[model samples]
Target chain A: MKVRVTVMLKEGVLDPQGKAIGHALHTLGFPGVEAVRVGKIIDLDLKSTDAQAARAEAEKMASELLANLVIEDFTVEVLG
Target chain B: MKVRVTVMLKEGVLDPQGKAIGHALHTLGFPGVEAVRVGKIIDLDLKSTDAQAARAEAEKMASELLANLVIEDFTVEVLG
Candidate 1:
């Protein structure tokens, strides 16, 4: 099975790296590029046979090591 | 308009950051987590009224500012 996890900073969280990227875009003449929020995408290949178990395991992975739950939120997508 | 740009390390490229994260996952007891490849997702709000133009512009943004073309690839998705 394949899974994709996206981890993003929650709203109202300060993202200095994202701000830097947004500034870079403006300097590169990308007009109307108001803001840029940068997040993470984690692609995984798992051997689990059950889809629900895989998702639950992946969610546990996300909460445990993949994301900073205090300031970030994550979503998981399972793919065949 | 809302757009999402995902930038990922190209195949065969060495991703030390991703490897470190994978190791961390293993140490945290995430069994069967074979590998973890980390990428970036950029969310943007644009003022463009045309969908095609917005996608093209966002692609340009990804190429010019969001992704390192030498070792990375990017995809753009437009959302209402």
Candidate 2:
């Protein structure tokens, strides 16, 4: 099974890296680029075949080690 | 308009960051986790309304500024 976990900084969280990227985009002449929020996409390959079981396990993985729950939020997607 | 650019390390490219994350997950007791590849998701809010144009512009942004073309590949997705 394949799973994707998207980890993003929650709203109101300061993201220096994203700011830097946004500045870079502006410098590169991308006009009208309002905001750029950068996040992580973690693609996981698991041995399990069950989608529900894999999603549950991946969600645990996200909460346990993949995300900083205090300032970040994560969503899990199970893909075949 | 909203656009998302997904940047990923090219195959055969060494990703120490991803390896470290995988190791961390293993230590945290995710036994079925086979592999983990980490990438970036750049969310952009643009002023344009044309989805096609926005996607093209975002693709250009990804290639020129957001992704390292030598070692990274990017895909652009336009969201309503």
Candidate 3:
């Protein structure tokens, strides 16, 4: 089984890196690029036999290790 | 207009952050998690009247700032 976890900073959080990228885009003549928010995607290769079990475990992984619940949120997608 | 850019490390590139996350998952008892790869997503808010032009400009932004073409690849998705 395979899983993809997407972790994003919560709304209202300031993203310095994203802001820097937006500024670079503006300087490069990409007009009207008002804002940019950056997030992370984690692709996982797993050897689980049960899809349901794998999803459960992956969610646990997100909460425990893959994401920081204080300032971020995450979603998990399973792919066979 | 809005654009989403996804940047990923090329295959065969070493990702220490991803490896660290994988180790954490393993320690948390996520069995069968063989590998993890990390990528980035950048969400953009643009004020373009033309979607086609917005996409083209966003691609250039990805090439010049959002991604390192030497070791990374990127894709852009436009949203109205």
Candidate 4:
């Protein structure tokens, strides 16, 4: 099974990289863009054939090693 | 308008980060995981109200600034 993990900074946390991206967009003549938030995606191919098992295992990887649960939120999408 | 851009490295490209993450996961006793590919997500809040216009604008930002056309492929997902 293939699992896709998307992680983003939690709300209320300031993202300096996002602010820089917004500034860069404006400088590049795309002033219509208001804000930008950058996040991460991790795609994993699991050995398990079960969808539920793969998602549960991927979620474990995400929470333990893939994402910072303190300030980042992650969603595991099973793309089997 | 809200637009999401998911960027991933082109196929066959080396992913050291992904490999490192995979190693860490196995080290943490998750040997069931096979392979991992790491990508990026860029969320943009545009001033435009039109979904089509927002997607077009977000695509431009992605190709011009958010993604490198040489080694990365990006998809724009427009969310109202």
lDDT of each: 0.87, 0.91, 0.88, 0.94
TM-score attained by model 3? 0.91
- Per-residue lDDT tens digits of candidate 1, residues A10-49? 9999988888877887787887777778899998777787
* Residue ranges of candidate 4 with Cα displaced over 4 Å: none
Clashing pairs in 2: none
lDDT of 4 by residue, B7-57 (tens): 999999899999998898889999987999999999999999999999999
Lowest summed lDDT across 10 adjacent residues in model 3 chain A is found at: A23-32
Candidate 4, residues A1-80: lDDT per residue as tens digits? Answer: 99999999999889999999999999989999898899999999999999999999989888988899999999999999
lDDT tens digits, residues B1-80, model 2? 98999999999999888888888888878878888898999999998899999998998898888899999999999887
Q: What is the lDDT of residue A67 in candidate 4?
A: 92
lDDT of 1 by residue, B10-68 (tens): 99999888788778887878768777788999998777878898899999888877889
Choose 2 or 4, whichever is better by DockQ.
Answer: 4
Best by DockQ: 4
Report iRMS values in order: 1.1, 0.7, 1.0, 0.6
Alpha carbon deviation, residue A75, candidate 2 (Å)? 0.8
Query: Against the correct fold, how does model 1 do in TM-score?
Result: 0.94
Candidate topping TM-score:
4
* i-RMSD of model 2 (Å, 1 decimal): 0.7
Cα lDDT tens digits for candidate 2, A1-80: 99999999999999888888888888889877888888999999998999999999999988988899999999999888
Q: Per-residue CA lDDT of candidate 3, range A13-75, in tens?
A: 889988997887778777689999999999998888788877887898899888899999999
Task: Show the colliding residue pairs in model 3.
Answer: none
Clashing pairs in 1: none
